[model samples]
Target: MDAIDLASLLCSRLCHDLLSPVGALNNGIELLADEQDPDMRERCMELLSESARASANKLKFFRLAFGAGGGFGDEIDTREARTALEGLYGADKRIDLGWMVTDEKMAKGAVKLLLNLGMIAGDALVRGGRLDVGAEQRDGALEMVIRAEGPRILLDPKLREVIAQGHSGGEVEPRAAGAWLAHSLASQAGGSIQLNDPADEVLLIGVTLPN
Candidate 1:
């Protein structure tokens, strides 16, 4: 992998992760300056605290998964990965997380591959669903799979094209942007993404990350 390309990917990942909390902080401050009620002030504080915690958890998760240190050149902490996945789910989202891998450090490439796959799975469930994620170490390599099952599976054609490498940056629909990004990241990491058609009320995404 080219160092410059890797650096660019990491930069994009970091910027994406920080936007949520920063936006929340700005909104919370604006509300505080205008609202005068004591109860409302307490509510704003709570919002700020929740957003801050979410941001911190995401950063910690990404540091190990995408940063230069923490097993990038070696194996990743599987326990930490599990915790990070759960933390990203948060309390508001109604998604279930499942694990089927041994508690061991995965390679840096595998970590990045899984993170992008997780983003795809999370995005598939708009009205809420079960996100079943699993990884198996087979023949000294990792094979990851993410299954998104929900009532309604919204598949965007443009996003599908992005996953298939048929399109690049364009005025694509916003709802499918996450999956498109996931596809792009996977492509950059020397991995492949497979999205099963909307059949049997399930949207399955399978990825293979070469070690």
Candidate 2:
């Protein structure tokens, strides 16, 4: 990937992840300014604490996956990666994780690719569902598949566009930011994303990474 494109992608990712907790912090401050009750103040403090922790964990995970320390030429720390994934999704027991591949270090690009795919799968499951994430080495390349199965699948059209084209410069009519980011990351990693739109149920995302 070109340096300029890579920089833009990283900036986009940073802005996207930081917005949530930072917005929560702002809301907490506003509540503190208007509320005088002791109990309410305690609740606001708790909100702030939770938001801070969530933001920190996200940054830690992104840093390892997107930063220079982790890359194609370097070995990823599998333990750290698993811990980060758990931090991101383990809080809710709704989504059961099925790992088909061995716990081994992967390329940094592969790590980011898989994480983004997982995020997409999670988004498809609005009412909670099962996510099966697996990786395999095939034909001198690495292939990753994320299967999301739920009673109802919420497929955003804008996200479908991003996954198919790799870029979209328009108003955010829906929650397609995550899909756009996933497309950018996949393009940078010399990979492509394929979605299976079954007529009945389940949304499957397939990503292939060049080794």
Question: Model 2, 18-72: lDDT tens per residue?
Answer: 8999899899989989999999999999999888877887787667655665343
Candidate 2, overall lDDT? 0.72
Error of 1 at 194 (Å): 2.8
Report the lDDT of model 2 for residue 82. Answer: 62
Across 1-211, the per-residue lDDT of candidate 1 in tens digits comes to: 2345445555676677789887998899899899999999999999999888888887876665556544346667777777777787745667777776664877665665576567556666777788777888677556778787877666566766766672465544433444455565577667787878755478777777665
Q: Considering summed lDDT, which 10 consecutive residues are worst modelled in model 1?
A: 171-180
Q: Which stretches of candidate 2 lie over 4 Å from their true place?
A: 1-10, 29-38, 64-66, 69-73, 92-94, 168-192, 198-200
| Model 1 lDDT on a 0 to 1 scale | 0.69
